[model samples]
Target: MAGRLRCPNCAAPLRLAGRVLRCAGGHAFDVARQGYVALAPPRRRLAPGDSPEMVAARETFLAGGHYRAIAEAITEATPAELIPSAGGAPLALDLGAGTGYYLAALLDDRSGWQGIALDASRPALRRAVRAHPQIAAVACDVWQELPVQDACADLLLNAFAPRNGPEIARVLAPSGALVVVTPTQSHLREIVDALGLLDVDADKQGRLHAALAPRLQSERRRELEFTMTLDHEQLRALIAMGPSAHHLQPRQVAERLARLPQRMRVGASLLIETFRRSGAAGASA
Candidate 1:
């Protein structure tokens, strides 16, 4: 854990001193030996976020370029029209940002875009801040009100994380764009079947629209599909990026993985949907 942890309770700047992150306001949070802090309130303990291992897996899997297409899609869908007149860099939020890979990709060439990388997992936040200096890694959950001020974000990017449409709406600047990237139904289909995981349903898009219809207007949607070849080590990395890594027994995964081809052709699919936050007349009650 970094010494300079911000106090979640009092919004005070904190510094690491031995075992705890302490603020002048006297709020102290213990740093777990495994390198994460519990920032959630008691009632929010059950909120589902990535575990430390899951974060590691995502970091490794994304580092391999298997997900480059998603990154490219994000760049292509950026709201270029909103960049000017803002007078400063665009404010982008990577909700559930893991290791800051995607956010870092978006921040690469463009100057002046301040990124807030929010995640419940402190390890992920730590990795994010270290990986991307431009990002301010905040430890928080997405389901609750975002810690940011209302109408401040120029764009919100939710990739492979749960969505809170109303919460997202409140945080977006009027005309702010909401870009969501989700796996398509057939995404990693071969691997899902081979590994005995549940398949993404055909109704995923319909449900997405149903959830956001009243509060958002979909501007555009694009689907990307590609194939990548992975060795055994890469296969292990990919498995780690999923829930089965935590849910399934190690023996089961190992046994299944052992039977896979040394370098297999894996299909990947993703949908990039951009929406404008409905405000005033378009606001959801």
Candidate 2:
């Protein structure tokens, strides 16, 4: 609610008056009590991307700083020029942003930066906006056109989300960077094996590269490793943040949890890749 929200139709800056957001051309949208909107029309609704329980679990785990390294890397890589408003006032976008933890962490590292946190879950955005004043939480599907304008974002962060690379490339200006963080094979392997769910595939990076080749060029790639030991409550929270948690039955999950040690050593791996967008990408959602 700082700068006028950009009009989804024409990328014009919107005017906020009372509970309504209106573009210069007179297209109007409503603001919810949680301070976000549904820009996607009926035709665009897909499966709900995240559940309330998942979002809550993620928020709990992230608040404990379990993913601190990734947040630090993101802060370090933010280009100075892209941070338009100086004194740490950057305009960043966190796509499929769950609980706004990474964005909140980056803002903490570099003060005064503002961000737009987008997710399909209203519950997640509700929790996110409360965490930081700088963030403008928006509930929207990632597959649809993002609500912001072209070349307006300093950094685009997608952590474990469905990516539309061409669309991401369109929104980034020259020298603007996109950071995609995906889990590696060893990450959550023990849980996956125990739950009888799909394992992290070997060709995930290759598939990402192939999918993103049209609009992005990789600038740097780094592998991060960390170990987190969780008590039962933390273990339950961590498990609920993943896809397996959604797919498994409650009793089955409880049974498996009972079998685990009082404290479990969980090793995790992440690939942090920074990319620059190629030209020829257009704003088509």
Candidate 3:
């Protein structure tokens, strides 16, 4: 809803007037025809986060529900009592919310909740807007100061996205929780070497928690692992949708995928951690 969005220029609450969102400070952001809006700082240019091709590949891959367990695990961890609400309506913020797949799943039965998909990519927002009726797509870099009302979000979800610990701590309400989903070392191990895909870092999660120690405390953790049967086509989408796509050429990727069997069992492993503000919450995040 417009009530949560603040102007990146003046930090004022945005009001929806017709198809435009304007703040009292006279800063206006136009809603795109695709049903989303850009809220990046007006003075700074955003480096296109994901290309249209990459976004398309990710959309196709997620639509197949290859990672449905990740979404389900997040929903299972957050009970009704754990989620905060604003005026009886829950608010969910998904960082690096590519296509808003996980957020859509979380809000499936919660009709009273609104989900905001924040990403730096315009291409991703195009599909994110249609992920759910209550989803509001905004284009903004997650590493910078989020353009949302302070302490307004009831829940924040970060799945395979960048984390801005300070900014995250600043935006979360006192009782709100932050759920982060990351891949374990075993994830994609079957095909990582064969396809030269990006390798998972086992200790990455450790560093993440340490970085947020000043403001957040991990409350719960879960490991969700499964094997998915993916054909060459599905495998290609998985490859093209992530960081490896940037390092590999189109021909190289196609050639590598061709070497795979008709169907390959790919391991899907993830570590989900739920965190809430710590005793140092008042410290400058």
Give me the candidate number with maximum TM-score.
3
lDDT of 2: 0.75
lDDT of 2 at 196: 63
How would the candidate models be sorted by TM-score, starting from the highest? 3, 2, 1
Report per-prediction Cα RMSD to one decimal.
Answer: 4.9, 4.1, 2.7
Return the TM-score for candidate 3, rounded to 2 decimals.
0.95
lDDT of residue 51 for candidate 3: 90
TM-score of 1: 0.82
Tens digit per residue, CA lDDT, model 1, 151-206: 66777888888777777777677767888998887888888888886577788788
lDDT of 2 by residue, 203-275 (tens): 9899889878877877778888888887778877777888777677768778888888888778778888877
Which candidate number has the best lDDT? Answer: 3
Candidate 1: what lDDT?
A: 0.74
In model 2, the runs with Cα more than 4 Å from the true position are: 1-5, 9-13, 80-89, 279-285
lDDT to native, each model: 0.74, 0.75, 0.87
Give the residue spans of candidate 1 off by over 4 A. 1-48, 83-88, 279-285
